[model samples]
Target: MINNNSVTFIMAGRRQRRRRWLLVTGLLTALACILCCFMLLLGNTIYPVNEVLRALSGEQINGVSFAINTIRLPRMLTGLIAGFAFGIAGNTFQTMLRNPLASPDVIGITAGSSAAAVFCILILHTSGAIVSIASVIAGLITVLLIYIFSRGCTFSIGRLILIGIGIQAMLNALISYLLLVGAQQDIPAALRWLSGSLNGSQMDELPPLAITVLLFAPIVILLGKHLSMLELGEQSAISLGVNTDMTRITLIVSAVCMIALATATTGPIAFVAFLSGPIAKRLVGAGFSNALPAGLVGINLVLGADLIGQFAFDVRYPVGIITGILGAPYLIFLLIRMNRKGDL
Candidate 1:
């Protein structure tokens, strides 16, 4: 039944897909680099690339040094790292669950982290490491609860998503209640963080997020093939000799840690996690893993949205506002399409 012509055609198609994946991924990486450069060079005062480089190299270049080192660098790093976390995490959940709506942001994982952070800010009057720690812990706890409740004799993606959305609603209500009773002075800080501004990002705050991503990203990437197999459903993954349970747990844990740290840092930048995976999947096509591409796409969206927010309007909007504006219409479109397909 095997034919040389069919085999040859299949091989050619495989090669073409691989080439496309490489091309798209390379371009995304280049664009992200360009955005990073712009983040450094184009601030209140525009500095030339050479001056930015010199400043980065520890040269005392007057105002450029402080602006680049103290302000822009940290902001850029925060967006870059956080966006990567969101993208990869979002993609992992969507792929594993076979549903776009399963994103941590959509499901209430971010809300759980946000709720914890807000509680720390309002009730406990805490900041720094305490808030971040609480966020990570809360995110883990939230996902654990979702997992426990959604499991039965058989696992159901539908049940998990429903539970997640319900939890999100409850957590959001808690956030609102906290805001209502909290001190007026603390409200402004909490609101700014909730809106996900990169403003006031400091170098020291970058380490926990940066280290978490660095540690976990490789694990995700290494297991990317197994993750893709998981997209075929549990039985199919098992038939393919993949340890579905271990793979799922590894991915969920890794993704949750990264996203939680990111939420702690950026206060749940809207929809970056939700949008990155599908976009990356479309770009990279079917054969290759979309994890890295998703991360790159996330970097572009966050940095691009931040830039638009900063300069596109008379009043600078927070990054979350820009991303929210971008994501809302897509969400509506997705719902309509899913409904048309009887998937809702």
Candidate 2:
């Protein structure tokens, strides 16, 4: 049982896995950094990377200072933070549920936040702090409702997803109703938020999200091992001494907190949450923690799409529209594949 050859083989396998993880993470980090710089330097009046760096370092350089420090900086930061949050939260759900399709975006978590935020904009006539608070509260409530409805004699990811879809449909209708009754002046703002743009994101609006991401991300990463364990199914995870219920609740709350804030900050940003996880998984492979890598993918997706939406297209679409285009086909393909296998 303790053969020297077997021990050596196991050691070699572990080393190989470690190397793959390192390579994937390093590539993702580099890609994210390049995109971040690109976001800063490319715009209507393209600034040199040096000028951009100067502005970031608190230098005052006229157009470069205003563009880099004020306008583009907030937008870029929002994308990075929100993308990371979305990626981590989405990947968490997918991992816990063992279903590629089981993401907050696909389910109804973001919709909850969206509905609340839209309501606040239209009904409450709220802005800033109140709106963000409402979004977080709404998102938590929506997930709670989904969980309650989906709870049955046995735990079922499929059932939860189905219920979430139904809830999403209802919430979409509510959002449409608000749009119909909303004032003409508010409609544009509401639509823009719904479509998810970072055009005029204020610097002041970022601190809450930054703090949230910093706070909960470590918790999620710490729980990554437990998350991986949960993949073994509830009974098996419990057998392995995981407090299944407690772990899920804590993870869900932390994730919803990040997702809601990000949605409030950037209007859900379409499939950043849904697409980032699967994409990162493909690149990073299995048998290792993919949470951080997934977050990196999210940052890249958001920044890249925002860049493309801003510069690549003449029409100047919102980030959400571009992400929607990217995500919709994959969703359809997934559905088709699932149907063929009778999983739908």
Candidate 3:
């Protein structure tokens, strides 16, 4: 049972797994970079890569600077940061809850932000900074309430999800009410924002979102080791010397900050968070933590879908529309599977 060949074979297997994980992560990161570059270059007035770089380097190349640096660069950066945040935040929730359907978009956090932003837009006639501020506040309150209501004698993932669904339904109803009583002039803008376009993103508005991600993203990554242990269930995690409650709270707070900021910046980009984690896991396999991989997948999906929405069809659609079309089928399939298993 303790032969040298057996030991050598096990070592070799680990080495192979390490190599595969590295390869997958590297490839996904590279792909995201390529998509980001394409997002900058492939617009109405296409510029050469060198000119785009020149514009980025703060050189005043007239139209090129305005187009690339002013317009396209901000849009691309918005997509890049927001997509990564959604992906990482969504994956953290799904992995921590051990449920594929527990993303913020599905569970009402995004709904909370949407509802507040719609209210500010249609009713209060707010714009820019105030709307973003309102959405962040609403998102945090929604998640905190969800956590409070979902905690019973003992915490249950199933119960938390059920409660989140109910909250989502209520928020959707609120959004509908706000829409119905709104002025015609305000409704179209609200609808367009709800549809989640990066059309009018400004460089000035991105600092808060960028700052939030920069601060919390490292916390999430640093805790990635403990985060992976969460999937082993609370009792198991505790037995292994992990402080489950502290770990969960830390992660939930960090993730919510990123998710709220991202949503405020770009609205909910359909299912970027919902779809990225599983895809990353499939690509990277299971022996290692896939947080970074999942973020990369989110970046790729958002940027790629945006490109498709912009150029693939005769009429350009919002990025959310394309992602919604792609994610709907997957959602239906997942629902059917869960229903058959009596988990819905």
TM-score head-to-head 2 vs 3, winner: 2
Q: Best candidate, lDDT-wise?
A: 1
lDDT per residue (tens digit) for residues 1-344 in model 1: 46988999999999999999999999999999999988998877898889989999999988999999999999999999999999999999999999999999999999999999999999999887898789889999999999999998988898899999999999999999999999999999999999998999999999999999999999998999999999998889999999988898899889999999899999989999999999999999999899999999999999999999998999999999999999999989998998899887
TM-score rank, highest first?
1, 2, 3
Q: Tell me the deviation in Å of residue 272 in model 1.
A: 0.3
Model 1 global lDDT (CA atoms, 0 to 1): 0.94
- By summed lDDT, the worst window of 10 consecutive residues in model 2 runs over 280-289
lDDT per residue for candidate 2 within 117-206, as digits (tens), equals 999999889988888899999999999899899999987888999999999999999999999999889999999999989889879999
TM-score of each: 0.97, 0.97, 0.95
Q: What are the clash counts of all predictions, listed in order?
A: 0, 0, 0
RMSD of model 3 against the true structure = 1.8
Residue pairs with clashing backbones, model 1? none
Off by over 4 Å in 1: none
